[model samples]
Target: MKNDTVGRLKMGYLPLAFVFLFFATELSSQVNIADPFVLRVDGKFYLYGTDDKKPNDGIPVLVSDDMVNWSGPAGNAAGKLALAKGSSYGTRGFWAPFVVQNNHMFYMYYTANEKIAVATSDSPLGPFMQQEFRPLNDSLKEIDPHVFIDDDGRKYIYFVRLINGNRTFAAELADDMRSLKPGTVVECINQSQPWEIISGNKWPVTEAPAILKHQGKYYLFYTANDFRSPAYNVGYAVSASPLGPFVKYKENPLIRQTDKIKGTGGCEFVTGPGEKLYMFYHAHADEQSPTPRRTLFSNAIFVPGKAAGESIFQVSENKVFLKSSAR
Candidate 1:
């Protein structure tokens, strides 16, 4: 695969390891959450994602009064939410469900069998009901749906779609959040950058896009490279507007595996009760294992100086420490 394409494919799950490693502990008895999508509601923390064990079973949920201590069996503690009736398109199990609260409704955006769908519920922990069949774009292979609601009460859904044969496209959703608006699907990045193109074979890449708007500028963090390869890493792009004209970070691969955390990528950010930003992700427990199991991790995001335009941020190794005791 081409190097640029490799980077884009690896983006799906690499930065997540940085988050999991940040909260690493000596206690071996604690439960680990992988592909975690965190939310703070009613003064409590709720995490929803798939358990790493099966990767193709039902989606898992974990509850914590505090972010530090997460407790649950891999598949037992919480209820499993499956595809709604008439939506049996998923041959494989459900994977990567991201939830957002809009107008007193909890909307879950998820991927199953490489197609994206939406489910709705009243509570964060939901017996969610699927409401859509086809993806926003009928022609594209859709996966990794991340819903972003801007400050103006306008809703936008960002996700990875296959365009051409060897590249991924980032597109915006309609206000209904079910279909892509005309002229909204924009080609954000291609798998042809100098670092991504490799060995004369360009890998169609790009997945797991997480966006954060801070101080009037939009920052898009994504994973790249082959998910099954050791070279998988995370990269970033910046845009003046959410719709893009995104400029790639000069020092791409913002977060990657070093000697400490082996497998990386799949990252999402959450703000706690006190307005603290925390990045959550997953990584492999043992880099050398042929079939390495992934563990969830967390880290902090910081901006050194306030500037316009675009600047780069780096993901570094953080000492694992208890941030809060279970309430």
Candidate 2:
């Protein structure tokens, strides 16, 4: 009789114990990761993000078996630096890294002090070495390097040119995967929509370039306005060609600040488990924080119908997508 009573007591405590452990693990594993990018390799999601939240760290990365749980080196992110600071290009300011694999090497296209550079590593988790310590072209005034290799085996790198009020441009990467093809560079998109105007945006800003090829159309997703401004939001443009004459979706901003989740922008799209398309983005920690720290969130993205144009892409739970996940 005593044994049966003890067993019941232990069973009752087990569920509470698990709930406590889950919260503890989540608090330790995930921190503020901004300008976030997630790459799925070997059935695992590897995350890389700007060094903004971490003090004195060059760049930080997180790893996860499932998208729900993430961790830095050794399962804590507070003091770890994945990419060291100080480079031939510039010492500081690394943001928005887009990583891809080719020829058994992982290539990270990232910004250093607002200049674009590349670093290579054998593994996704890297102390990536910068073999070519210079920007792609000393003449190309650009930042935010997002690399996309199309189904046809051709590669393209889309980047933001700060020259004309934060416009974006695309160029075909030469067969080597670093330098651009001589005459393939073209201006892709810029801010003209009304919602793009924000408080700190004196001129205009359309940055954070991410490309997706769907339904025989190239979709360019970008963020507008100052990231610090509450007006920051995500929008899309459609084009037939990778080097695009992209047309902005009539609805303009796709993801916007909700009463619950404010300042939603700077996102990347990746295929999650079950062939689902998910968007990983950063928003102010909650509605209360407003313009301060940014936290990473992932939500399902819906692309309806076979044809592409207008409201072809719909994001579920605009008011509470992040809230859907307990994390």
Candidate 3:
């Protein structure tokens, strides 16, 4: 059903209604987390997710400023544990953890027993130091590990492979942001639409990938089904470059599942202070249905018109309004 967003912003922009995410409450139970990953060092904003693996294979760090008050990743709160515990591929099963920063260092990309790794830190609150423990490609089944760096600076590395199931891949990274730059990998999107099937036609699904470039194109956001169904939301694809042939957005699932947040797909997109653009996700915190505990949300992503890089984005309307109040 190739999205319309009000007939493609009425042919050139002028439709703004939906704009959500202002969570601090609802589904309470002190918001346990899931697949979220965000980082913005100095101006302060660091959140990593999917923790609670019995006392410490570690991976839970929270600290927000106005992304609507997000403290408490557990116990002594103020949220800590930015990727600890040793690894040569063995230390529990930390699922997703993605961080990026260039020259001044700070480069963490995670996932353990299912492969995909990289760690190094100068700060972003980390004891992170896996120093190339290997697995960018060792046969498939990789994990979600995003890292996009473009605008003429080139450094891409979006992941998620599983042969015939969860597919989303990209390459081009070498400048020591930890290898990969041999043939430019590339295999962008998979899992054909129809609301991303679920049990038939090329089933399986996509994974969490987050790329955003605007104007010059290259928006790849992902997240399809079975992220504990409720139809795990979010979908996007478009590319002029950034290792792609991408093109899935006939008005696709650019974020869905609501009626009190039963699905919001693991997401990440950043930018702040005068640049704005925000989107951090995690929500399965059922108010009356699907539940498994996943709570950490945010919104605000715009691109209304006025031209610059060729405007056409509004995928930040999950609920579009929900005040703040959970702690």
Candidate 4:
């Protein structure tokens, strides 16, 4: 909202619309992955997301060197998927994917048919397959899986459960990392902020959970409002423990709708080429619509909050547009 782009280009600044046009050619011509999640392993970045292009083919992945200029759905030639449908779980509705490496194996936690599942592969460019094809729990519909491991080696899975609305929850994971530790499931956050009410429906919503443990605090990042609305955006809560009474930031909607970017939610953080922290997110195809999303990258930094003794994360107004040649 502050328009840092203007100040950065003061010497030879083109009109904002023209600048958008220039970047549009570099971006719109390629990558269209929605609900994007990027994983950096061994100096290379692997991107996984809701495959709108091949919704029923399991999760699709792309490889990149600089977090821009992507190559391949990697192994998705001839309809092959990183996690193929038949080889894993769920029949349709493949969405939001987050991957983590543990015990020398890459585990991909993702959504399919509104359910959560984890698949494993030897390589980051995965032919990820499930050991057992089943949802984490079939009792209720759930989606958007994010796995976080504590410094003590405790594993937790954070996700959204469709109850009164889309509420965020977390549960300690079993040793196998395929199921939950019984009786550990706990509600993490609710749709309490005014900005979260953009859906204008009876059901309030808070989805897309990504957790970060920093300075002994658990930062629970989530997206609110219906993903379809341009008002959809991201916010975060903080707690002393992984599952807890988390407090939403006093100043929220960290990332929001800008003149050139809309529907700014569904994000994940990754350390990029220069060891700089970057947030990968998707905006609607254009300024006025919410379909055919395009991925965008922005630098993120930790900052002191308005409240005393509080720290928060901020995303830069600057952004990078890259083409996903594989798309």
Q: Per-model C-alpha lDDT, please?
A: 0.58, 0.69, 0.65, 0.78
Q: What is the lDDT for 130 in model 2?
A: 71
What are the per-residue Cα lDDT tens digits for candidate 1 across 200-310? 445556567777775566778777665555555667787877778888876677664667565466677776534545666656555665133354444445344455543
Q: Candidate 2 overall Cα lDDT vs. reference?
A: 0.69
| Candidate achieving higher TM-score, 1 or 2 | 2
Best-performing candidate as measured by TM-score: 4
Ranking by lDDT: 4, 2, 3, 1
Q: lDDT by residue for model 3 over 149-257, one digit each (tens)?
A: 7656767888888787888898988977777989888789888878877765455878888777654667788988877677788888878887779888776776655
User: Relative to the unseen true structure, what is the C-alpha lDDT of residue 209 in candidate 3, on a scale of 0 to 100?
Assistant: 87
Model 3 scores a TM of 0.31
Count of clashing residue pairs in every prediction = 34, 0, 9, 1
Compose the digit string of candidate 4's lDDT tens values, residues 1-327: 110111121121112542364466564356788899988777788888986667887787788776777887685423546787788888898899888888789888889889998888888777888767888888899999988877778888899999989999999999998989999999988988888886347878899998766656778889988887888899999999988779998789997457878888888877664455677888888877777788887777776667776667777777666576644
Top candidate when judged by lDDT against the true structure = 4
- Which residue runs does candidate 3 get wrong by more than 4 Å? 1-27, 37-49, 52-93, 97-110, 117-169, 172-182, 186-209, 212-216, 220-239, 242-294, 299-302, 312-327
Order of the predicted models by TM-score, top scorer first: 4, 2, 1, 3
**What C-alpha RMSD separates each model from the true structure?**
7.4, 10.6, 18.6, 6.1
TM-score of each: 0.78, 0.82, 0.31, 0.89
